[model samples]
Target: MALFAVLSGLSACGLPRSGPTKGEIRAGSVEEQGDTFIVPVTAQVARATAMVPPLGFTNGFLGAGVIGSDVIRPGDVLGLTIWENVDNGLLAGPGMNSTALQEMQVDGDGFIFVPYAGRIQAAGNTPEALRRIITEKLDAQTPDPQVTVARIAGDGATVSVMGGVGGQGVYPIERPTRTLSAMLAKAGGVIIEPEIAQIVVTRGHHTGRVWLKDLYSNPQFDVALRPGDVILVEKDQRNFTAIGATGAQNRVHFETQELSAIEAIAQVGGLSTNAADPTGVFVLRDEDPATANTVLGRTDLIGPQRVAYVLDLTEPSGLFNARDFMIRDGDTVYVTEAPYTRWQKLLGALTGAAGSANSLSKAAGN
Candidate 1:
């Protein structure tokens, strides 16, 4: 009877649990105390929470028209060559009929000085336009002067490319690289996996982002590049935590832009088949007031509410619901241990105690 009592007490003792049981979770959901609300994962809940915000270029970034690449700007270097009709023209050398001028840089004030042509506004004019202007300026002294302007190396109309790209530097916006996609290619493309790569374009005060893959599929996202634009290519940072009775416990990053609950579970190696309770898979997130109201079908909730969305895999529509339910960044996906798992642990403990008593009794008999 003494040995029986000891084993009974051991069985009555609290057993280790992976997480809160389904009933305990439901009981603790009190809106008055600001406790986590237990929202069952229904089709309605899935649809309501599916309204995830999309990432793409804004109107300001998309609506801007492409600028002409050949249009000269300040800081552009020009090489001018002039052929005069007269033997002794204003710019002609003693024995030469033509003159060559190299390294003529456009000043900060958008003016470039030529010996015979005087200071000319070189900025905002194409090379051809500048050539015509210079010819007209020198025509009186040089007699129908023929002028040619060639664009040399310049700092005008450039973009800074950094982060996860093959080459990171300041790239000029030329004819073949006037758009975002073209600029990315000129920078040696994204070094990371295209599916997980994110491209961010910052112009002035406004910024926009899109998936690297989306740039090709969506024409609107392939926005025209602007001067002084900063482009960054990097991996997606969005992730969720997998805990409790899952096969693995870690923060798993999103493999794509949109991640569903089913895919999130799979990424963590799925739930433990032996210990996981099929009826108690929960996704924990802090729901904003607007989203919380939509999920709970109430309006009085204010601020960010702690919400625990429960998914029962044993139900008929369980798989479908999980597939439809989107897993957001910073969410915690937890699976409760099966009820039998705790019972098994308790039974094992009691059996070990009983076996020890029997062994002690046998030793005394000897």
Candidate 2:
């Protein structure tokens, strides 16, 4: 009776489990509360979910023409030099024939104060335009007045670049740095990996974003930048959690701009060979109402719904379908253990119990 009790206790001991079984997962779904949704990964589902809105520059950013780099702004500084034909003219003094006025900052109201020219609007006008205006004003006082205006450094036609960039500072918009990609290069390029790099451009109230690689691949994404534009180069924050019977379960970041389900699985070292159930691989995520309805082909669900997408690798077209399926951010990839694994554990326990019983019999005989 004691030997039988020992064998029964060993067989009934709780077995260690990597994750819930396939049948258990299906049974755990709550229809009323919308806790878990089990949906098979079909061709239609893959195509539907792949229709997520892509990020890029919109018409507001794309349609705007490139701004003139030579144009002056309110915060710009100017160096004015006045050369008069006569030796003691209005600007020049004594034996001096020319007068140099350096570091003339344009005021907030877009005006710069000159001795003879009074208050001149220098913000909208270029250096040459300012020269003509100053020459006209000083001509009455000094005969044949010659004026030259040179733009110095300031906040005019500039952008603020920060975050994950080689150089973080205010960059002036020059001829070579007029567009989004050009400005990124002006900032010494992105510091993070290009594949996972994302560029965000904020102009006024509007904001646009695109992958760093897309700037070259898609020319339309390289939109013209405006003054006061704030650009940020950052690494992709999108990542998924891998658990259950995978090679190494952890939070895996996206390696590329667009990650497919197969690629996501491979990044986590693929499914566990020994214990993984090929038909039980699941990708779990919280789907928005629209996406949830589309995937389940039902309209009763509302708000964010819990969805578990099952992928059967044993199918004939499983690999191809998985390659087409897209994995989103904050998703969980779970691979349930095979049914035979639990039975194997039970058999191993029974063998160990039998070995203990045989040892007791040997000791009694001795």
Which candidate leads the pack in TM-score?
1
Cα lDDT tens digits for candidate 1, 1-366: 975676557645766667778777777787545498989999999999987677899999999888897788898778899998877777777978898999788899899999877999999998899999998888777677888998765677778999998899987777788899998998898899988899999999999999888888999998988988999999999999999899899989999788899899899988898899988999999988999998888999999989999998889999999999999989999999898886777678878877999999999999
> How many clashes (backbone N, Cα, C below 3 Å) per candidate?
0, 0
- Measured against the true structure, the TM-scores of the candidates, in listed sequence, are 0.79, 0.78
The numbered model that scores best in lDDT is 1
Give the TM-score comparing model 2 with the true structure, all chains together: 0.78
Residue pairs that clash (backbone atoms under 3 angstroms), model 2: none
* Weakest ten-residue segment in model 1 by summed lDDT: 6-15
Worst 10 contiguous positions by lDDT, candidate 2? 3-12
- Supply candidate 1's per-residue lDDT for 337: 87
User: What CA root-mean-square deviation does each model show from the true structure?
Assistant: 4.8, 4.7
Report lDDT (Cα) of residue 7, candidate 2: 50
Tell me the whole-model lDDT of each prediction, alpha carbons only. Answer: 0.87, 0.86
